[model samples]
Target chain A: MRGAILHAPGDVRFETRDDPEIIDNTDAIIRMSATCVCGSDLWDYRGINPVSEPAPIGHEYVGVVEAVGSEVTTIRPGQFVIGSFFASDGTCPHCQAGYQTSCQHREFVGAGGAQAEALRVPLADGTLVATPEIPSDELLPSLLAASDVLGTGWYAAVAAGVQPGSTVAVVGDGAVGLLGVLAAKQLGAERIIAMSRHEPRQRLAREFGASDIVTERGDEGVARIMDLTRGVGADAVLECVGTPESMQQALRSTRPGGGVGIVGVPHGVSIDGEQLFYSHVRVQGGPAPVRRFLPELVELILNGEINPGKVFDLDLPLSEVAEGYAAMDERRAIKTLLRP
Target chain B: MRGAILHAPGDVRFETRDDPEIIDNTDAIIRMSATCVCGSDLWDYRGINPVSEPAPIGHEYVGVVEAVGSEVTTIRPGQFVIGSFFASDGTCPHCQAGYQTSCQHREFVGAGGAQAEALRVPLADGTLVATPEIPSDELLPSLLAASDVLGTGWYAAVAAGVQPGSTVAVVGDGAVGLLGVLAAKQLGAERIIAMSRHEPRQRLAREFGASDIVTERGDEGVARIMDLTRGVGADAVLECVGTPESMQQALRSTRPGGGVGIVGVPHGVSIDGEQLFYSHVRVQGGPAPVRRFLPELVELILNGEINPGKVFDLDLPLSEVAEGYAAMDERRAIKTLLRP
Candidate 1:
């Protein structure tokens, strides 16, 4: 088998690797049909997150089950499935509460790396949700998105308390942020303001149902949101960028008694308790419990109610994995879809 | 008129001052029936919050309307009323959304000092909630409690998402925290855990509906809460202490997908963004939208359904204001009620 491995900063290589196998009775081997470069992956690729040694990359995938261990039930070989970055036991208290990412017996699915031709997924019955059928080639990208970005964006919107008639603001313009605009719209938000400086991303944001666009950053962005919402601020704000500035913008852009949903992987962010206390805003965020939303998101994708796959602007063969990383790193692609 | 003034840390004096009068068309002058020393007041008395100059102190009070400005409506001069520390225009968007503390046209009711015989209240119709009738002296203390502490505690429980059968933990055992236990009980929480080291406060907490008392502080406190909940953590946590330690304890005590409602005025508290992000806990805190809950709280107090005023273990005349501050500052009294 071959997979993408990060040897060091800016060094992703498509190299031969040991084939994935079922090591536990609850595990299953997946023959991946598609995988992609994630915005989070750029952390290690840019040396912001130290890559101590060569390691497999990628956590998002749409695949067909190649084999299942003896104890696995409800999921079988030949089935097409989408799973979250974290494999959770569906029966755990946290999982039952819809926080699968915090499941007591959870495992990071990216440990073996979904960027490979095949991958091992633990807690198969709990982690993977099968599609109604093997999806069409055109539906592949959207199904792949449900594995992470789409689910994450949807979680961000839900966590922000977006509802019918809510005025929403998204603090990042990345793939997840653009999808967040889509999620807010699906949640019936009456207005969505996307903060972006890029031309192409702005166009995609508008297409994804952003009612307004603000090309500012930091205080200016918050001020623009307040201005647009008649100085009351948005009812909900989605924080898709994990920086201190973006978090502050999201917090400040929400109306009193409103919510700020954070989906970004925080880097060096710190919040002043006093400021948060006085803001009268509710905040809830974490690694998206993608598993909780997978089934519904898959249904929506298959039914053509949503087209989250539009985030994939650059598609390439799996062998060109390094090029995919570079494209996203250089801002040449919103997201890169790689065919296995 | 004479009122309590903080000349400096530990220096409180009952001195003569100009009588309060209606300053705005929406203002009303109230002859105070009762005022109490709050845990928050000790911050200034202890010098944790600096007293730049001699300033009128006190923000909790229940009183009789002495006079009403020309434009005041819905309230009469002879009515008994309870008001929050912050006066808000009920017509503001934030107020309409049940976050009156963040009302755009807000006034600090404490600025003129609530400890005096007469105090001016801004946005009279928006800020003051009249009782059904003028009650006997026995109801004064309870009505005063609703003006701040009880309302704050109720807001904490509500913000923490307390619901039927919820397991709730309170992080402070002051008047507010003790009442938070009562609030949790009123909200139908099945288990109320009060965190306190003081025996007297602990007894009051139990009396207020705390099913369990944990004397641990900091990390040990969180560990005990987890142990009590069988390692799953409480469904809701009330943070009634503003220190960083208390905030951390509240956050760590809540289960993933749970809520932490904070009411304490935060001091020098900074939360690590990554820690909060991974916790999967929803946090909502502020000064508390007390005005939003005033009516219901007053009704509850009047009906004898709750006795939050029991927090005032020490009672004194208005002239002995200095002793009231000292008793609370030295922890000799849970709270002090001052009569005019």
Candidate 2:
């Protein structure tokens, strides 16, 4: 087997690796059908997140189960399935509350790296949700997206409280933010403002149901959103970029009594308690509990209700995984889909 | 008119002042029936919130409408009224959204000093909620409590998403926190944990419907709450204290996907974004939108469904307003009620 490993900044290598196998009774090994480069992956690829040692990297995938541990139930070999980056024991109190990412018995499924020919997923019965059938080739990308980005964007919109007649603002131009625009639209938001500086991303955002696009950043972006909303600010704002400035913009662009759903992993963000208190805004963010929405999102994708696969602008063979990483890191691709 | 003024830390003086008069078209002058010392006042009294000069103090009151400006409507002279500390034009978008405290056309109603014999309340038609009829003397304290503390506590519980059978933890034991216990109970929270070290406040909390009391602070307090909830943490946590420690305690005490409602006017609180991001807890805070809850709270008090006034443990005439402040500052009283 081969997989992508990050050895240092600007260095991703696709090299031979040991084949994945069931490590526990709850584990299942899946032969990867599709995988992709994630925006979060760039965190380590850029050295912003230190790489103390070479490690397998990707965490998003859709695959066919190749084998299952003796105790694995519900998920069987020969089925096509998707799972979140985090493997959760679905019966935990946190998982029961629909926050599988915070489950008491959780494991980072990315530890074995989904960028490989095959990967081992723990708590298989709880983590993986199989499609009704093996999805067609054209539906592959969207199904893979259900493993992370699409579900994440959906969670962001739901967490932001986007509802019928809601005015929503998304503060990032990445795949997640664009999908957030789609999610908000699906959730019945009446108006969606996408803040983006890139032409291609802006176009995709508009196609994904962004009613307006603001080619500005920081304070200027907030002002534009406020101006567009007639100074009341949006009913919900999605913070898809994990920087302090992006978070602030998202927070400030929301109306009093509105919500800000942050899906970005904060790098160096600190919120002043007084400012938040006085803003009268509600904030909820975390690693998206993608598992909670996997079934519905998979259904939506299969029914052709959504086309999240549009986010994959670049595709390559799994052997060219390093190039895929470079394409996304260099802004040459919104996201890269790799066929394994 | 006479009012209490803070000239410096620990220096509250009762002295003659100009009579409050209607200044805005929406203004109404009210003759104070009762005003109380608030925990927030101690911030200034303790010099934590700097006092630049001698300023009229107090923001909570139950009073009789004495006069109204030419354009004032809805409220009539001689009506017994209860209003929030922040006056709001009821027609503003924020007010319509039930966040009157964040209303665009907001005014600090306490500018004229609610501790005085007379107060000029702006946005009279919006801010003041009149009782069904002139209440007997006994209901004065409860009505006054609705002006701020009770309303704040109620907002905390409401914002924290308290629902039937919820496990709620209140992180403060002052007047507002004590009343938060009452609010949680009224909201149908099955298990209420009141954090307090003071025996008197603890007793009051139990009376207010605290099912359990944890006499610990900071980390230990969080541990106690976690232990009580079988390590799952409370479903909703009310943060009625404005300090960073209290905020952290409240955040730490909530289970994933739960909520923390904060009503305290934060002085020096900052939330670490990464910590909050990973916690999967929703946090919403601000000055209580007391005006939104005024009518309902007033009815509850009038019907004797709740008795929040029990927080006022000491009483004094307007002339001894200084002693009232001193007693609250010295912790001799949970709260002090002043009569004019």
Candidate 3:
């Protein structure tokens, strides 16, 4: 099997690798149907995040289960499944409380483009949510989206406490941010301001139900949001970018008694507590409990309520996986989907 | 009129001052019946917070309305009133949203202590919530407690999202923290943990419905809380101390999907966003919206649902107010109530 591997910072290669096999009683193996390069993948590839050694890369995948171990009761071979970046047992105390990202038996699905030709999944019954049937070919990209980005955006909106008639602001215009616009809309937010400078992504944001778009960055962006809401700020702010500036912008865009749901993968960020205290804005965000929202997002996509597959700007064969990474790293793509 | 003034750090003195008179159409002149020294007052008194000049001090008060301006219709002359430290125009957006402390036209009553024999209150009709009639002599202490400490604790518990059958933790052992234990119990939290070391406070916490007491501080305290909850941590944590250690401990003690309500006046504190992100804890705290909870707290006290007055350990005449500050600053008293 061929997969993408990160040898070091700036060194991503497509290479042949041994096929994965079911190892544990609760494990299952899947033949990858489709995979994608994540915005987070750029962290290691661009060397912003130091890659200590050659490491397995991808965590998002929509694939066909090919084999299952003895204890795997829910998922069976030949079923279509969508898996999240974080694999959760789905029945732990945390999972039961609907925080699967923080599940007691949680594990990161970081294997060298495990979403390539074949992949091994642990905690199979809990981590994988199978669709009713093998999804039609036309529904593949959207189903693949439920694996991470859409589920993550849904979590961000829910964490931000977006409600009917809420005025929401989304920071960052990546796939996650765009989908956050959709999520907030679906959650009944009356107004959504998407902060984006990119033309293509902003178009998708508008299509995703953003009522307005502010091209300003950082403080100016926050000022725009405040202005839009009559200087009171938005009721909910979705922070999808994990930078200090983005975090500050998100916090500033929310009114007192509002909330900021931060879904960004924070690297190293410090928040001034005094400012937060004075802002009176609630903060709640973490790794998206993707598994918690996977079922609903799958339904939304399957039922045609949201078409998040529009985020895919570049698509290619699994053999040209290197190009997919390059297009995203060089800012030519919003998201790159790889057909394996 | 006579009032208490902070001439310098550790230098509180009684001084003669001009009598307060109605300053606006909505203002009222109050003859103070009682005022109390707060834990926050010690911050500036100890020189930890900067003070440029001899500042008029004290914010908590229970008084009889001596005079009412034309616009003060709800409160009239001779009515006993319990007012929050911050006087808010109850009709403002923030006040209507239950964050009266951040009201657009907020007046800090303690900027110059209501501890004075006579004081002017702004927005009297809104700031002062009146009893049906002047309370009996025995209810004075308890009603005075509702002016700030008890109301603030109720705000913290509400902000923490403590629910019936939930396990809650109080992160400070001061008057507010002790009252928070009572509020949590009243709010129907199944288990209340008070983080305290002082014998007197521990006893008060127990009496106020604290089911467990963790004497450790910082990380050790968090560990103890986790141990008490069988390693799942508390469902809600009330942060009544604004210091970094207490704030972090409060954050750490909450479960992954729990809430932390912070009421302590934040000084100089910074939190690592990554740690907060990974923890998946919701953070909501700021100046207590005491005015919003004042009505309910008054009912609770009136009905004997709680007895927050027990937190007052020292009582002094208004003339000996300096002694009240000394008692609290030296940690010899949990709270000091001064009768004017």
Q: For residues A171-272, what per-residue lDDT tens digits would candidate 2 score against the true structure?
A: 999999999999999999999999999999999999999999998877888888889988999999999999999999999999999999999999999999
* Model 2 ranges with Cα > 4 A deviation: none
Task: Give lDDT tens digits, candidate 1, residues A1-340.
Answer: 9999999999999999999988999999999999999999999999999999999999998899999999899999999999999999999899999999999999999999999899999999999999768989999999998899999999999999999999999999999999999999999999999999999999999999998999988788888898999999999999999999999999999999999999999999999999999999999999999999988898899899999999999999999999999999999999999998
Evaluated against the true structure, the overall lDDT of model 3 is: 0.89
| Candidate 1: tens digits of C-alpha lDDT, residues B1-340 | 9899999999999999999977799999999899988899899999999889999999998889989999998989999999999999999899999999999999899999998888999999999999888987998888898889999999999999999999999999999999999999999999999999999999999999999999998889989999999999999999999999999999999999999999988999998999999999999999988999998888888888988889999999999999999998888999999988
For all candidates, state DockQ relative to the true structure. Answer: 0.93, 0.94, 0.77
Candidate 3 A-chain TM-score: 0.98
TM-score of 2: 0.99
Interface RMSD against the true structure, candidate 1: 0.5
By how many angstroms RMSD does model 1 differ from the true structure? Answer: 0.8
**Model 1: what is its DockQ?**
0.93
Model 1: CA > 4 A from native: none
Error of 1 at B95 (Å): 0.6
